[model samples]
Target: MFEKVLIANRGEIALRIHRACREMGIHTVAVHSTADADAMHVRLADESVCIGPPSARDSYLNIPAILSAATITGADAIHPGIGFMAENAQFAEMVEEHGFTFIGPTPEHIRIMGDKVTAKRTVQSLGMPCVPGSDGPLDTVEDALATAKRIGYPVLIKAAAGGGGKGMKVALGPEQLREAYQLARGEARGAFGNDQVYMEKYLAKPRHIEIQVLADTHGNAVHFGERDCSVQRRHQKVVEEGPSPALNAEQRAHIGGIAANVVRELGYRGVGTIEFLFEDGQFYFIEMNTRLQVEHTVTEMITGIDLVREQIRVAAGAPLGYGQDAIRFQGHSIECRINAEHPDTFMPSPGRIDGYHAPGGLGVRVDSALYDGYRIPPHYDSLIAKLVVHGASRNECLMRLRRALEEFVIGGVETSLPLHRRIISEPDFINGSYDIHWLEHLLGLKG
Candidate 1:
């Protein structure tokens, strides 16, 4: 076991990792920007180090400073909590090269799964179902048009190295292909510094489903299950639930088995998510997230597992000690990502939190670092908290989620609480009839 671990990110995830470390009798070193000197994770960690100013590029993403902090603290391992440097293959290699463990997948796996074009080919070769589209990155507008025609109308152009809906464009017909292709490439170049883009046959209504898998260095891999993240806005997940209402027992087992097998074959280590798009009873491989996901809480709730602790254990050369059959799935779980933003306008709301009250009672959990007087710095992501609830069934889980959302309160700054409340009450969401575009349609953003 590692004596000390350095957390290389901020917000609730950092605190989440800190709690897991404490439970395993490991000390933590919290590295933060100047603006987060008083952050809750920093306050709770065994030690804290200020790496840089308020800017994320100067602090959270500063590899040299983070490595220095870990060295000075004598930490044995580093946990790059979601975002920032979490999926950076270079960062993972550097950490191992500098004689510290990276509590995630191998750098080789990260590199293979980082680019969309390569990921699609790799997964397809692994016998996973994939959406029909261009075999590789399109070289020109003519190539894109040819691929779009072959794939039929309404094709989606995506960046080879893109995420969070950036570097993505849709064209409904041949006439719109050139503009959408150029725009997608431009966005790709601006966001990821890579102009490479690929094409896919766009499905009008598809549910965003992902399988959560964990593997050990000892050739053992198991999948917790699937999460239905269909309720999205601009490709950002809002509400996530386990044992998707759309899938039956057979479908769940089939996909889950495939995911576990893939990771085992690839020699993957640590936690990773294999994302897919489900439409018309078929599942299409989209991409893989190499690090821990923000919605991991819901999976943990459904399956009695401490993913962070497992990640740490695997990094320390511990075997899983069990197989897939030993794993059991329990009740249904739901998670609402409460961002510090307006519910209606969807604008960032970062400021001092005057008063805060988290909901309580059985089957309700709120993961947050907010305090009564904590000032939310405007420099980082606006996600302030995660409200996760579990129950015996999906219906019971929704009811519990509704009550938890109503009981929760964060004063002084607007939040998306109201929006979540509205979503839970909607008939589509109540009956699990929503898709990836459902939220945008509900918000009148889509026609």
Candidate 2:
């Protein structure tokens, strides 16, 4: 076991990792920007370092500074709690090269899955279904046009190395393909420093489902069911639930097995998420997240597994303590991403939190680092907390979620709490029949 672990991110995720480390008797070192000196994670860590200013490029994303902090703190491992350099192949390689363990997949696996084009091809070769599109990256406008025509109208041009909805566009025909392709490439290059773009047949409405798989150095891998993340906006998930309401027992087992097999076949380690688009009762590969997801709480709630602790154990060369059959999943779980943003316009709202009160009840959990006087820095993402709930059934979970949302309180800055309440009250959402486009359609109707 690592004596000390340095967390390489901020906000709720950093705190989440810190809590996990404490439970395992591992000392934690928190690296933060100047603006986060008072951040909860920094306060709770055994030690801390002010890496740089508020800018992410100078702090959380600053590899040299983070490595230096880890070295000075004598950290045996670094846990990049999602975002920033979590999926960066170069970062992973550098960590290992510098003689420190990275609590994630191998650098090679990260590289393979980092590129959208290669990931799709690799998964397809493994017998995973994929949407029909360009076999590889399309280099020119003509190439994109040809691919779009072959794949039919409404094709999606996406960045090969992009996530969080950046570097993506939709074109219904040749007339719109050129601009869309160019824009996607430019955005991809700016966001990920890789302009390679690929095309895929767009599904008008599909549920975003993902399988969470965990592996260890001893060649054991297991999956903990699936999460339905269909309620989304701008290609970002807003609400997520476990044991997808859309899938039955057979389907869950089938997809979960496939996800686990992919990890075992590649000899991968740590925690990873395999995402898919579900339509017409069929699942198609989307992409793989090479780190712990923000919604991992819901999976843990349903499966009774602490993913962070498992991730740390795997990185330390420990074998999985349990097998597939030993794993048992319980009832339904839901997670609502509490962001500091306007409910209607979804604009970022960062400031000092005047009052804060988290709901408490059976099976309700709120993962946050916010305090009454804590100031939300504008330099980071708007997500401030995660409200997760679990119940015996999906219907009961929804009811608990509704009551919990109503009980949540925040002041000084607007939040998405109201929007979540409205969403939970809607018939389609309550019925668990919403798709990827459902949130956008709901907003459009309100407009």
Give the whole-model CA lDDT for all candidates, comma-separated: 0.95, 0.94
Tens digits of lDDT, candidate 2, 1-447: 999999999999999999999999999999999999999999999999999999999999899999999999999999989899999889999999999999999999999999899999998888888988999999899999988878898999999988989999998888888889999999999997999999999998899999999999888999999999999988889999998889998998998899999889888989999999999989999999999999999999999999999999999999998899998889999999999999988999999999999999999999999999999999999999999999999899999999999999989999999999999899998888899999989999422
* Pairs with steric clashes in candidate 1: none
lDDT of 2 at 249: 89
Enumerate clash totals for all models, in the order shown. Answer: 0, 0
Question: What ranges in model 1 sit over 4 Å off?
Answer: none
Against the true structure, candidate 1 reaches a TM-score of 0.99
Listing every candidate in turn, what is its Cα RMSD in Å to the true structure after a full C-alpha superposition?
0.6, 1.3
